[model samples]
Target chain A: MQGRTRNIYLIPYMLWIVLFVVAPIALIMYYSMFNIDGAWSLENYRRFFTPVYLSMTLRSFWYAILITGFALLIAYPTAYLLTKTEHKQLWLMLIILPSWINLLLKVYAFIGILGFYGPINSFLRIIGIGSRQILFTGFSFIFVAVYIFIPYMILPVFNALEELNPSLVDAARDLGASPWATFRRVIFPLTVSGVKAGCRAVFIPALSLFMITRLIAGNRVITLGTAIEQHFLVTQDWGMGSTIAVFLIIAMGLTMIMTENGKLVK
Target chain B: MKKVMQMFITVVIAALGLMYLTFVLNSQQGYSGGNTLTVYNWGDYIDPELITKFQQETGIKIIYQTFDSNEAMLTKIAQGGTSFDVAIPSDYAISKMKEQGLLIPLDHCKIPNLKYIDPRFLDLPFDENNEYSAPYFWGTLGIIYNPEILEGMEFTSWNDLWDERLRNEILLYDSAREVIGMGLNSLHYSLNDTDIDHLMEAKRKLDALSPNIKAIVGDEVKMLLANEEAAIGVVWSGDASEIIGANDKLDYVIPDEGTNIWFDNIVIPAGAKNVEGAHLFINFMLDPENAAQNTEYVGYSTPNMKALEYLPEEITGDVRFYPGSDITDKFELYENLGKKMTAYYNELFLEFKMHRK
Candidate 1:
């Protein structure tokens, strides 16, 4: 009776998940299998396999990987350092401060910082390099993407690091292991969940980002996100858009499963 | 205990059911009252004060909403979720709406002020008989250039966009039609050509023009060009008007090769809940004084014949605004291509963008 009563608390949330989440995914799968005329065919998915579109998918994966890698590299150290600090809450707040601003505002702020006559160029000109275009480069695209998505990477890892058992490291050191080996064999292995969690958190959104690619990257980055926008918004081809979205959805599910696999390993 | 659990589940379900009921009811409702008019238009496309004036004169309240793109507006209307009495879609979009039977023929008797609309804006291919649409604002695709970059070099033709010296110094329109249309016009072809071969040629021309173009941009082109990030930007005349207002070095020209002329016109959709209120609103907007105020505030030229008398000569004399100077013969209107052909254009546009990457 007690367990049944507790299960009742989940009904509202389950209803929401059904209405907003599961329903939309089902609708997208339905749309992906049919044309605008409601005729069922594999044409939409076939279009995704064409050479040009295949390249876009690859490009999306490439950018997503780089974003995840950089985010993990930067966030691990910051999160590890935060675990040693007294005011973890204050430090986390400072780390996530920029994300509190609206995304578009953050993008514009990046533009102002990296534009042709922006502060970066002005400072460079003072050092005699002359003004150069930085706002629309590939560097700016990845930099802004990492900037926007780093917070997601940090919080999970920070929690994992905070909850880490310290006696295990001391035990490994007491067992005649060097400090380096202690960290390599004990601490790092224990934090795999956090690293996996951080990667899962950062990689999925990075794969499908549309606005940052357009604003900071100029029209150069041809990722899956922009292709979906063109089909859905510009071309009004909902079927193709849904097809790409279905792929992205599957990719996200697989990523989540991979993180689950990491948890099961322990 | 079983009875308590069942009762708890029932209460939770009832609460959720109430929330869902409210959501469904609120998604749509009859206009606030019989006299309320729901107007859907582009963002910043109208003068807000004119809406207040219309309400004061007619005692009809308006619920105004804005959409950023015609595609978004079309999708909303086609879904039949919202019933808007008045909507402003561009020329090709209005034609698409008409073909889909989403629009109702305007009752001419209700819009008696239609006589004040410019004849040049009437009887065009989109609505040849003026049966469905009335022009609200129109402009041409043109280039806004910095005199500092093109000093003593006349930017009188499309070839100027391809100047070798302009490499990485140009911003093209992000729109597929305008970008591909310029390529068509450069080869002396129609802007609305759906021929596969012609489009292939246009694709080739665009590929060649790629080295010069820094980016294909939308509304951001205004701020970018004004800030001198690019030497030239392809944009609508009204955007150029706003851009030139901000930056002294900038000037606009509709190149002699040809250009797409577009109009945003008002229409009543078939599912409109208040047709009478919509017609009244349209006619009120056509009134000369109201049109002139809209023209001044929106910074786009009006089609009201009598509104010109009230506009300052700066607008009247600006060749980009009035379109009386040169290239009148080169005015081309974008026609609504059927779904299959539209897919072709979209495919080619995607290929072009992919090729750039």
Candidate 2:
């Protein structure tokens, strides 16, 4: 009777999940198997295996990995610092502030800060490198992606770090485990779940981020997101777009599974 | 506990009252065709006043929305989830939309004021008889340059982008078709060329120009040019006008390689509930005064002949907006390349990314 009541309370949330998540995903799969003109075909998937598509898929994965690595490097410390802070509440608010701004707005703000004629460029020019443009480079794209996903990475790792018992560290020190050695083995291994969660959060979104990439990277940077968007929007090739989307989902899913397995091993 | 219960009841009553007020307002406005009408159009492309006027005229409240690209608009409409009564899509998009059966043919008689449209725009190749779309606005893509920076160099053709001197000094439209098509045109091939060799050559040309590009930009071209961040930008003539209005040093040129002549048209989607209201609004916009005012505010050319007549001589005579016959002849209107070719172009565009890496 208690189980039945709990399930009934979950009905609204389950309905929401069905409507927003399951429906779109199912539609993507369904559309992927068929051409837009209403004929069933495997041609979309076949085309996706072409060199061009494979190369794009590779690039997206590579970029996402790069962003995740950078995010982890930056976020772990920020999370550690926040966890160590006396005013934990205030520190949490500071880390959460950037996430409060819309993702696109954050990206656009980054562009204004980093573009060729942006403040950084203006300062660079003042120092003597005249007329060098930084607007459309690969660096800017990665920079923006890292900035956007850092919060996602930080929050999860922060949660894990915050939950750590002070006694564990005290015990380590009593046993004469140096600070670096203690952190390397104890703190990190224990925070693996948070790190895994943070990686999933950042990597998945980064791999499929077309809009920010398009805006900051000057539409010159192509990712799986742009490919899907192009197929669906510009070409009206829903099949190809959906196929690309499914491919991305599968790729991300496989990576996540691998990450989880890796965590288990550790 | 009693005070808390009173507060809760008072809050619920207020919420109910708000809902009732909204229902009454919607009914009074006569826009009660449905709960919402999701209009997908270019961001910042329309005059908000026009939307306000449309609502005021017919009690039809508009839930205006925007898309950054035609493709974005098409994607949402194709899914057929959200209900949209009307959409203003560019010429090429209208052709593709009609081909996909996503649009319903306009009842010309219902849009009575469509007669005020310029004859030149009416019988255009995209929608020969204006069957599916009514011209909303028209413009050509060209160079909007800052003379202070571009000082000695003449900006006449698309070839200028490839000039080693101008390398990393020019800005191009971020759209794939615009970038590739103009690159193809610079090489003297048809912008719609489907031949792999032709596309490869266009890609090579684009690659050569890419190293010199400051940025491949969209909406910000106006601001970039105005701020003198970009020496020259490939943009619509209307955008050039806005930039020039803001900064007198900005001058526009219809590149000698010709340009893309784009027309945005109003089309009623196939399953519109507010078909009558849509037609009424379309006709109302066709009025010369309204049309001219829209042209003035939006900085795009009007297809309304009466509106053209009302435009000041300076605007109508502006060569960028109304280019010479020779320059106009070089430009081409984009056509619906069908699905396969669009896919091919998208692939080629992706290829550029791979090459960059």
Candidate 3:
């Protein structure tokens, strides 16, 4: 009876996934297999593997990894602090505030913070420091991606920390393990699933990030999302667009599978 | 009392769910009608008062929407979910829409001020005789540079895009065609080059110039130039005006390679429900006074010659808007590159973007 009730409770969520996520992804697959110009062809796939696009795919991958790595480094400390904080709710709200703003607005706001005449430069002038050319480089893109995704990393990790067996840490200390060893041996393994989940959340979006990078990095940076967007909109070639999209989906799929398997191992 | 509170909670939850359902369904379905005339155009492209004036005149409310790029505007139309009565698309997009049967051709007889448009803008590459599109505003793509930073430097050609002196001080527009087309024009090739070798040449030129480029900007190009984040940039004539308005030190120059002169026009979609209304709106906008108001607001050259008479001498006399006959005569209007060529151009653009240093 309890098993039947649990299945009943899942019905709405299952229907939602079917209608929204599953359907759109399935459509993408169907579209990817056919030529968008009212025919069937694999030319889109053939063209994708060329040196130019392959390099872009690799560049985008590394950029995303770097962004996710930075986000993890920043968020883990903050999430851990929040877990220990008395004002946990307030701190969480502060961490999540920027995520509530439109993504584009936050990016443009970065221009005011990082641009040539922005506050950073003006402050530098006051202190007789550096110049104003730091805002449009590839580094700026990664910074913006990490800023936007930090909360995504923080939330999962924070939840994992919140649910941790705190007494296990105490018992490890009682058995004479150092703080670092206790965390590595006890806390880290328990939180690995959340870290994996957080990494996926941050990395997937960061990998395909386009508008913010385009806006903030000033088009000096290119990612797979921008390439697909150009094919679909500028070229009006849905075949090529769908093909690039398929590759992005596949790359993301492999990453998710690896992360999930890692979580299972934990 | 407990039952009453539970009923109240149930009612509130149901209401919230209904609201979410409505929002989701509405996005899928599209804008519903209620005396609203949806006008979609480039961002900051027109005066709000013009919309108000039209609404007051026609008793039909205006639903104004703006897009940042020509491609974005086209995507919205192609989505086939939204119904916009009036859209202002650039010359090439006008051609593409007409070819795709996405537009309803205008009955020239209905638009009286159509005569006010200079004959030069009428029989253009995209829509000859203004059949499917009415010339709303026109301008060229060129460099807007700060004289203070440029010092004694003079930019006379598209080759100026590669001037090493301006390295890391220059900004380029993010639009693919504008960037690639300038490169093509510099090489004495058509902006719509389909030849692989010509494209390769454009690519090589862009790649070499990429290091000098600080950013590929869009709407923020004006702000960047004004703030001195960039000393020089490729910009539309209208944006050049906005930057110049902000600072007296800026000047827009039409490259000697013959900059692209384009007209963004008002057109009715083939899927339009109110063709007559759209025609009326176009006619209303084309009236000399209304056209002048829009021109003043957007800071672009109006196609209507009669409207030019009402515009301030500073606006009408600006060299960028009313260029010398030599430059004006040399301007190229972008025409639609049919399907295959468009795909080829897109691929080249993608390749350039991917290989960026």
lDDT of each: 0.85, 0.81, 0.83
TM-score for candidate 3, residues paired by index: 0.88
Point out the higher-scoring one by TM-score: 1 or 2. 1
TM-score, one value per model = 0.90, 0.85, 0.88
The sequence of per-residue lDDT tens digits that candidate 3 reaches over residues B104-151 is 878888888798988888877788777789988888999888888788
Off by over 4 Å in 1: A1-14, A36-38, A170-182, A262-266, B1-32, B80-82, B150-152
C-alpha lDDT of candidate 2 relative to the true structure:
0.81
How do the residues A156-237 of candidate 3 rate in per-residue lDDT, one tens digit apiece? 9999989888998899999999999988998888898889999999999888887876788877778888887777767777
The docking quality of candidate 3, as DockQ, is 0.44
Candidate maximizing lDDT: 1
Model 2, span B176-295: residue lDDT tens: 788888778888888888888999999987777776777666687777778787788888877878898899997888877676888899888777777776777678778888898888
Tens-place lDDT digits, model 2, residues A1-266: 88977786698799999999999999999999987566999988898889888888888888999999999999999999888889987988887898888877887787678766788987888999775667667788898889888989999899888788789988998899999989987888889889999999999998999887667877667788988877776666888889999998898889788778856322
lDDT (Cα, tens digit) per residue for candidate 1, span B1-357: 578689989999999999888767655553354678889999988899999998888877889999988888998999989889999999999989888999999999999888998888887899878899888998898888998876756688887787888878888766788888888888888998978899999999888887787777678888999998888988898899889888978988888888889899999987898899899999988888889999999888788879888888888777777876245556999987766677778778777776762
